[model samples]
Target: MASKKHNDHYTDYFGITDKKVPFEDLDVHNDTRLFLDPHLVRLRTSPRPYWDQAVKCLDTFLETLTVRVLSRNEDPGDLLKHIQEPPETHLGMARHGYRGHAASDVIAQRIWESLTTDLYSLFRVGLLEHIEDLPLFVRGIDRDITSDITTRVFFDSLAQFTMSCMRQIPELSSRGTIQIEKTVWDPSHKQWAQRTYTVPKNNDGSGIILIPRGWVRKRLLGSASRFLQTETLTYIQHSRAQYDHRGKLVTPSKKTLRKELAKEPHQANIFYTEAAKRNRQNLIAQFWQYVDERYTEKGPNLGDGLARP
Candidate 1:
């Protein structure tokens, strides 16, 4: 009872290829043998997490397209009618063995047109609303993956696709030239203040300095524990070797250091030294300050009355 043409269109849109290999027969390491292109085959065993995230971004973009652009009357099943219909290349050709390369190209082009139009509209809305939509946009791109290609190869193709589309947007292309200043906590003043350096609009380099809170805690605690262990070992060893050339103990301070090290590392008189506490507090304060500066919305600054007389 289903229309054959409709079925074909759905299959093509979803990229349901004729390859009959069952899931049980598929193996990640052996996937190289599945593709026709040698370059694509090489990506069979490539890092998956990175590609998975990339695919997720693509998926998100497609989801946005479906939700924001598609009409209520149309379903994904109607994709064939929307796509630029490909020409019939081979007469009397069996559909199973013959790869519709030209048809694939047409489908890809139409999808790109749809994606670019929707993405540009989304960008315009975000600009007008003064909203930070880059994260959501990136997530949108990561959400739509209906491909059978290997993770690495798929991401490589996706990167090229995204780059091609983004190159057409002038605003996004000029993003690298724009810079904004971020505020930070000034330890000396004990108040929030603007940073001297301006960061790029894209904020690509911020990752190097903006460490996660959990990572900071782990690193700080780990370093403190290691330092305590080393100092404790050093004090115990020094106490035994503190005797003078005449075999009489001259440095009586070793006993005091040993007693101090014997207390719990977090105790006020022991490992919780003033320097250590100050360093920890500074790290925490800086992290919170960074969060406030990056996430908090500041009131608009009204320009000082006309011009000074």
Candidate 2:
């Protein structure tokens, strides 16, 4: 009976009585298909919410770093430092096994090439406003990389958040000594610093960083696929449509647009990139980001949906 037991969740393995815990019921053994979303992060306005301070740290640091890099005034060391593999939060899509946040010097190289070399006109026209937007308009950037950057920026706060949640669990509280040390952005100092945090132990004794149940979705807010299908296609539907002989404008349905865009991924990328560059004043990043946010506020969805509209 013991050998035949099937445990799919941490609670099942740990025998947690409270099934409706505040934090997500993560699988310590594998990566869950979820991402720590910044849109949701900003919605946390509960008095004394830990995320409020973290938002400043994250946005300011990412914008500053990107600006400095674009201006050719940034140090190579800082760029390399910013591109780091974040500790596993047990959230995100991972193949083979659950390696939460992953990136290396190669990603740093790609980012450098993207900013200075890639023909991403969106960056030059000022539409590439947020860090999350990189994956949308910039080639070689992916959700995994964005998720890594987000976790790194919110590292210390996540640790603190984990500690705060630990008190609500008896097993976690018993072992809550804040013993793990990791590098994180210190909002107080406006720089990265080392910090210790108490994390829930995995079955094999590894630490698991827990995110709030409402803080994640199946994909990041600026998901390329979702943005392409929704905002990008909507733009194409209007701009690409023509007037009939009766002088009435004809618009293609989403299904028709989707089928057209599905012909070639690169063709769709070029279409949206041009569309975004053309309507700089109208096609803002916040618009698309918010759409993903509102669709996922109900919490993480275990689906690979492109979040139409």
Candidate 3:
């Protein structure tokens, strides 16, 4: 009786009531042919709602991951502690220099390590949670299927689908060696440091390194001693002007003029202007360093032209 019912289900699925109607004789090209098999028609239409639910589930999962994993604030000092000391002074207080923070080498290593660890943790947790919640998100599917088995099947199907999509883009499908450059802040000298890695397409995921923008900025600013020096000088000169020499203001001394030119407002303005210019130059140099590291291919020389806008 069980065998008879199973055979009947197969017959209904193929839309063949009479065994005498050979499967090869059916007109496969006919538009009406697809509707003949109720199972085929249902399979084609059912995936839309399931896919919609899956996307919603993915969005919710990402939101949770961003809040819980990516946005967790860690102490700068603690993160810096993992940095390894470098052999020589590579960073400093000048333009494109690493400001003298705790130490450049140590800070750079720490930033790399902390970000990589955080990203790995995020990926692991996010994937696991998404798979675990699949049953809840995907509806009107086989309820008897185990979550573990379903998750595997879903991922396998997704991987196959992704590969098929990627085939349309030749650039993505091509296999080649790629170089990845990473910019790290060196604290000992206030500057950016770059490291490059060559990764083969086969071993691509193993070479992935994640660095947070906030972490990089924090290190860059932390090592920025040159800015501090300029600010200090400006503050000192301004403060000196506030003090009166007895009742009347004292004449500009040679030492004062040479050091800061604080006595004359015109000279003071010039000094501030020069300092501001230097700071801007330094920032521009830093920006160029990043540009060079990321976009290695030679192109038009924009140079100081970019400073205009």
Best by TM-score: 2
131-247: candidate 3 lDDT, tens digit per residue = 222222122111122111222222222222323323432332344434544343332332334545443222122221111111111011111122223333434344455446567
RMSD per model, one decimal: 26.0, 4.3, 26.2
Best by lDDT: 2
lDDT of each: 0.27, 0.63, 0.28
Global lDDT for candidate 2? 0.63
Better of 1 and 3 by lDDT: 3
Candidate structures ordered by TM-score, highest first: 2, 3, 1
How close is every model to the real structure, measured as TM-score? 0.19, 0.77, 0.20
Question: Which candidate would rank higher by TM-score, 2 or 3?
Answer: 2
* lDDT tens digits by residue: candidate 2, 1-309: 012134367666556778887677876567767767665566554323666766877777766656656676434455447556554586666643465336777777667765654534554566665666566655556666766777788777777777777776766544333367788777666677777776776654567777766776666666556667766677777777989999999988878877877655444654566665666634445455556566556444424454555
Kindly list the per-residue Cα lDDT of model 1 for residues 77-102, writing each as its tens digit: 33222221111111111233222222
The superposed Cα distance between candidate 1 and the true structure at residue 185, in angstroms, equals 3.5
Quote the RMSD, in angstroms, for model 1: 26.0
> What C-alpha lDDT, on a 0 to 100 scale, does residue 243 get in candidate 2?
91
- In order of listing, the candidates' clash counts read 15, 0, 16
- Give candidate 1's TM-score: 0.19
